[model samples]
Target: MRNLLNFIIRYGRWFVFAFYITISCLLLVSNNSYQQSIFLTSANLVSNSVYTGASEVTGYFHLKAINESLQASNAILENEVLNLRHQIDEYKTILADSIELPPVAKRFDYVQATVINNSVRHPRNYFSINRGAKDGVKVGMGVVDQNGIVGIVNVTGDRTSRVISILNETQHFSVRLKDTNFIGSLSWRGGDPSIAYMEQVPRHARYQAGDTIVTSGYSTTFPADIPVGVVMNRIHGSDDNFFILKVRLNSDFRALSTVRVIKDEYKSELDSLQSFDFSPTK
Candidate 1:
């Protein structure tokens, strides 16, 4: 208590000066309209700046959720586009007869997932997503990003799944030339992440620089017309029967953060065809 008294005695004059200064400023602002307006304006600016900085920090943390939501919406829209493309072509040729055909079912849906692990510099590259069998991500389901194709689900666990990336040399995807409707098998040669090779194209298949290549819909994996890559050029194949076109993939594997797993509605029924009981049995 004696030390406190000494300390106050030592700084009492300075404390008085500070107290008077604060009161003087407050009274000056309160008594003068111009000073009060200027004070309020400066205070508002400071408050706004603080609020803006805080809001930016909060938004940065929520970026992942926002991105995942956007990717999910985009996947749904892309699926709808594919279904519409199929329906438009079919209905345009109808003759308006009372033909009660089966209703065209919605063929695709998406499961949004984050790419937790990824690779591009390997002979057989694979990536892992945060979704699994519990999320309706099954083996052989197609994986895609907003830009284009990513891979196929290879193995699935209860909460995670690995995908055979499009860059894998052992993996081949059925893709078609958008201009020619010529279907081919897309494979990678294990060097460039951006490049792949499409084979089984006819020698006379018309292609120019930057021709679009998309899913052929011949497989049960990917839906029809999902973008795969763009043709860069053609190379001489070992056999003269087919042309091998070099392609630039649309998805940048290095930048894959979020992806969508494609769920084809008819995939199970289509896959069950091979196991159908056809022989005369009991």
Candidate 2:
């Protein structure tokens, strides 16, 4: 206790001086309006800078979520635009039919769906989407993206659906050459996602490299004239009756993010009407 008293006695004057200096500074700022205003401004600026830096760091960490939200929103807008375009085409068809009495035009609707999982490296590949029966998705519905037709939905649940991708070897789609309208069956060879084989194209048909291939609308899933791919190459079979042409697909399966599920409102009625002609003549 005596030692502490001696130390305090030794430094007491310096401590008193330091305390008085701090009190004097506070009194001067409080009494002087200009000095107080400057102090407040400086403190506010430093506080604002710190808050901005923290906010920027937080926002940087949230970029991925923001981008995903934007992609989902974009998917909705894209579906709406496609729907409007289809409506316009329908109106045009109606006008043309009224004038010339042509065949009835087919109609289609699209439901926006996000791709939850996809695979492009498998022989029998399938993709899953974030929509199902609860969202009006059903089996046999066609799935597509902005580029072109993707696949057909095969399995469905309340909130999820599975699609048999066009890249699958077992999945076949009917397509026609854009230039000659020669119909052929499109199937994958389990090679590459960007390539498929078009079979049963007659040898006599005019075949050209780079000619566009499009959906033939033979199936109730995809609409007519939807682009599928372009002819990449052609090879003749042993029988020489038909040519197997290579097609470069329009949709890039590796980077798929969003897609649309096509709903044919009149599919059941059409199927019922066409079911009576199933028997073939021998």
Candidate 3:
């Protein structure tokens, strides 16, 4: 107690001066309207800056979760859109059937799936999706994004499927020139994922750079007219009477996340027809 009294006595004058100085400053600012306004504005600005900085730090930590949530929401919305489109197509088919018109070819049925893993720089590129037989995904089903075709499903289990990307050298797809409808086979040279080569197009076929290429719907997997890529370059083959065209793919395999697995209702029928050959020589 005696020590406390001695310390207080020693600093008493300084403490009084500090307290009075604080009071004087407050009183001066309060009495001057402009000074009070300036003080408050400065205080508010500092507080806001501190708060904003803290908020940004917090948001940075939450970005991954936010992105995951956004991806899930996008998947849900895409499924709904696919359902609506299928319904509309069904209605059109019904109307045409009632009128005795020829049956229109079924294009594709969109089934939303998340990419579990993807690769771009590889000779035999493949991607795994978080959907399989349980999710109605099957082998040979076509996969695509809003931009264009990705690949064909090659392996399927109960809960997941692996897709052989169009970038794979072994992968081939039937595609056609958008303007001329001259169909050709699309294949990757195993060097670049961004580019593929279209072959079997006659040399006489007319093409210009930037002409769009799309799926030809000759196969049971992909539908007709789905955008594949744009023509980047064309060169006449030395031995064959066809043009070897380089195409820039629409889908970025490296960045693939969400995709739609197309299920055709008439796939079995189409497969049966494709297997049949009525050649008289045979």
Candidate 4:
């Protein structure tokens, strides 16, 4: 107690000065209109800057959640568009045949997933998503991003799945030229990540440099008409009978973040019918 008293006594004058200076500033600002206005303006400026900085920090943390929500909404819209197309086709069939067919069932389901891991530089490049068998993802299910097709799910775990990326050389998609409806096999040529080639398309397919390529929907793996890419100039390295047209992919594989796993509603039935053994038997 005696030592504390000595320390306070030593600094007492400084403390007294600080207290009077603060009081004088307050009184002077309160009595003078100009000073009061300046003080309020300075305080408001500091508070606004603080609030803005805090808001920016909070918003930055919310991007992932916002992105996931947006992806879910997009999935719903895509499904609705597909159903509308089916209705149009059904109407056309009824008009032509004068026979009422049963309502066309929904053909595809989407499971939104985050791309947990990815790579594009490797030859057999693959990515893993945060969904798997537990989330209704399965082997051979098609995966697509907001832009377009990304890959095919090749392996599935309980809570995660691995996808063979479209950038892989060994991976090929059954895609058709949008205008001519000519189907061809598309695969990455191993050099450029953004470019692939639609191989074995007939030379007389009537495609231009900017024709769109899309899924053929010929198999249960993917639904029809999902945009794959746009045709670049045709390359001269293939056989004379077929044109190998370069395609610039729509989905940016290098920046993959969110994707959807596609489920064919009647995949099991189709697979069973296609797999039945029809060889000669005794």
Candidate 5:
């Protein structure tokens, strides 16, 4: 205590001088309008910059939640679109043949999922999604992005599923030219990830470059008119009677991150019908 008192006594003059100096600076700024204005401006600028920085940091952390929310909202909208299309199809059927054919029922449902892994360079490219059996994803379900068809789910686990990408050589899609009923088969032919080919299209099928190709609805896997690509070029096929359409695929496989799995609600029913016993007992 005695030592502390002695130290304070020796430095007391310095402390007093420092206190007076701070007070003098405050008085000078308060008395001078220019200095006071500059001081307030600098303080507000620093405060705003700090606030903006903190806001950006907070927003960055909220991105994942925002994305998931968007995905969920998108899924609802897509389902609504499907229902509307189904209604349109039913109306068309009623208009076309009221006495014979019945209205077509809704056959597909969509499950939105995020792509965890994707590869486009390989000849048999595959994609991995974050949804699986637990989320109702199944083998043979068609997968598509917002732009177009992406792949088909080939394997499923409890929480993950692997898809056979449309870029794969083994993958084939039943596609047709937009505005016409002429159907063809679309497949990848090794090389460009952005390009695919539509085969078995008759030479007379009236089509042009920039014409859109879409799902034919011939298969039970995908719905009709889901966009696949745009026709870029047409060439003589191996048979010469058919034209091969060089298509620029709409789905960007390199940038793929999210997709929807198409669940054909009637697929099992169709499969069962195909397997129905018709042989007469001997």
Candidate 6:
């Protein structure tokens, strides 16, 4: 305290001068209309700038909450769309009066999850979602984002699950040309996140660049006609009999955030049936 007092005494004259100068400037500005106008304008501009900067900072922090809300909303809308489509099909059948049937039961149940971790540069890329067995997620369940197919669940824990991303070289699924029934095998050979390869396509199959690809419903994991990608190009395979298609995937794996885990209700039953050994022991 004694040192602070001594310091103040040393600088007291300068401090008094500064205080008088500040007061004099304020009085001059207040007395002069033009000066007052300029001062108010400058003050307003500074205040606006400060307010805008503060608002942007607040908004940046709130984005995560906003995104999660949107994801939940999208899940609800997607469920509604699925139900409506099924209802429309039911109505069409009823109008035809070909066969009286109840509304088709839903085949896929969606579990909305956030992508907590992802990889696109690896030979065997995987994704981790914030959902697990407790959330009805299980191994072999198909995972998809808003745009298209994403991956398949390979492992599940109590509150987290790992997915084998479709970008992985080892991942393979049956996809068909959207305009026809031509089915092919979808896989990835790495190096690109937005592109994948489709093979085993018969040369005779009618397809062209920009043709859309979708799930073939051959497996119990994903439902029929889920959007996968569009054909970018085609080349003759080593066999020369099949066409290797370059597909531009609809889902942007690099920007993946929210996804849905597709739960096939009859998957267990289908697996059990397929597990039966039909060959006789030699």
C-alpha local distance difference test of each model: 0.79, 0.78, 0.78, 0.79, 0.79, 0.80
Candidate 6 accuracy as lDDT: 0.80
Residue-pair clashes, model 2: 0
TM per model?
0.65, 0.63, 0.62, 0.65, 0.64, 0.66
Candidate 5: deviation at residue 226, Å? 0.2
Candidate 6 residue-wise lDDT, 58-103, digit = tens: 4355356557756875897899999999998898878876565689
lDDT tens digits, residues 1-282, model 2? 999999989999998999999998987556422222322321233433453455444435534654665577579779999999999789988886555567875578899986666678978777767677889998888998867899988767666676788988878899999856699999999977899999999988897789999999888899888889999899776657988999999887876666899988789887888886867789
Global lDDT for candidate 2? 0.78
lDDT of 3 by residue, 39-124 (tens): 23212334334534554444355346446645775797799999999997899888865555698865567899866566778777
Ranking by TM-score: 6, 4, 1, 5, 2, 3
Q: Write the per-residue lDDT of candidate 4 for residues 1-282, one digit (tens) a residue.
A: 989899889999998999999998987556422222322321233433453455445435546755775687589899999999999889888887666669989889999987766678877677767676878987889998877899998767666666788988778899999956799999997867899999989878887888899999998888999989999898875489987889999887776766899999999999999999899998
lDDT for 218 in candidate 4 is 90
Model 6 Cα displacement at 137 (Å)? 1.0
Better of 2 and 6 by TM-score: 6
Candidate achieving higher lDDT, 2 or 6: 6
Per-candidate total of colliding backbone pairs: 0, 0, 0, 0, 0, 0
Model 1: residue 106 alpha-carbon error in angstroms: 1.7
What TM-score does model 2 achieve against the real structure? 0.63
Select the stronger candidate by TM-score from 4 and 6. 6
Best by TM-score: 6
- Clashing pairs for model 5 are none
Q: Evaluate model 5: give its TM-score.
A: 0.64
